[model samples]
Target: MLEFDIWELYRMMLRSRLFENAVMKLWEEGKITGEMHLGTGEEAIVAGVVSQLIDGDAIAVTHRGTPQFIMRGIDPVLLLLEFFGHPKGLCKGQGGHMHLFSKEHLIAASGIVGSSGPAATGFALALSYKKQNNIAVAFFGEGAINQGMMLESMNLASVWNLPVLFVCCDNNWAVTTTTNKSIGGTLIDRAKGFGIEGCSVNGTDVEAVWELANEALSKIRNNGGPQFIHATCTHLEGHLLGDLLLRHNRDPVLMAETADSLKQYAGESLNEVLMLLRKIGGQTKKKGDPIVFIKKKLKDDADRLKLIEEEVTKQIDQVVNNALEISKGGMKND
Candidate 1:
């Protein structure tokens, strides 16, 4: 069982990696149109932070939100289809890499810069008004710190004591502009200016992010107001899809450095998880044909996908039924 959890974490990382590669390939092949931001190295932040969220919690994400959407239970196939602009996509082929909406999960991912902050604050405000203990998370980049809307949202969240967590994904660079050149002050300081608690975490370390976010979520659940966390992660790839080739900008050195860092962190975590799994007698299947391993994993994913689809359908049906019942009643004079 412990091995399962570790493997699951690794699997989620692999899925995000694969999904990113697929999207980049599509962009190169001219299949994916418009601007695309690929989150190749920042998978841990999304996976780790999202693991702390409950079923009914809401999430607001920035342009590089594919991993968050997947972590929130979006199917890889559906995500791929969405990238391909298929009719059966998450946004019905309307939203591409930057925009992803999953009503069932209460997620509203945006392409606009710093847009998620206010949306997250709004969700938190609604939850507070309804007396719900649900927490809302806003995932934005360091570049978003310069946007006025982010500050405004932070002020609103602090003033209202909303259950919102602002996650600043400090990937060092915001697009082509470096954070040092763009951001005037420290990210944590910005949170402090709003009278919110803040922490700086190693975004490459999934375990660290998970621990910190878990603690913050617990505080929010207990009505602790707003918190901000700066995840100092690395950007292993270009800002947008195909920009690497288009701009003739190569960062092989940075890519290798970031990969080494993540690998070191993952290795330590994997070893711990493996030890726990060994105590439970859970081990990976014996070496076999590569094709067989691929087939087995694919089959398992297919089954899980079916289950997720069924659950989403059921939720949609419930919403429809509720709406229909409300419509059936005659309009009462206010």
Candidate 2:
């Protein structure tokens, strides 16, 4: 028997892959509008980071946050429904592509480029001010480092010595703009400028990321200042929703040789990756064969829908009522 819960990890990775593939299909069929940033080869990063989080800890995510949010216990059906613009979405269909929020868990994500950093820092500051042990993790892309708000947030986070973990998913290219041309200096150097400890790790290695993140998080929980981790990963697909363009401008062989993480991880030929992709694609197709599955889900009983709606409403009402009661009466019943 194998050691460690490899089965669970494999299952989660499979689920993430299936979810992204389904979303791509929706995008192809003209269902999902707006830009779709697929986190194809970056599943390891989300899994590693989320494994360290407690139930109530907050997370601020960027546009490429679907995998992270899904890994954080968000239902796959609800996520799919959200992508399809259904009322049963996490955000009630208001947030598409990049906006996902769960108030109960204090988990919020944004679509804006490089915006989550500041929001995460603010959440951490609030936690510090309240003297709570809760920590906040901000997930952003390498492109975000160029944003002034991200830099400012780092400065504030360091100055306040907040319990915030800044994770940089440096996928090398920011929507086709090479990081070399766009990001000046190193990611660790930027963190050093803010007087925060920083490290650059291999993003594709889940074990490495998990170990490092755990140590960093432990330090932060002990009143250590904010930490920065630059995960240098690769993007197996194009920058966005569409198929690869600019074929003439780029060499396929060279590109394949350079940025494919699957090949790097497998330490094998590209053929191995192609075979694995084929296997995954075949299994996914089989799982989605029964159209009745989706049809039945879509045609859920009206009474059941109403009951669910009522339950959700009652929950919201109870929360609001409790808040009002706590505000009116102090901490003690006497």
Best lDDT among the predictions, by candidate number: 1
lDDT of all predictions, in order shown?
A: 0.71, 0.70
Residue range 158-276, candidate 1, lDDT tens digits: 99999999999886666556665787878888899999999998776666676788788778889999999899765555567555422332444654554466575787775654343
Worst 10 residues of 2 by lDDT: 286-295
TM-score for candidate 1, residues paired by index = 0.72
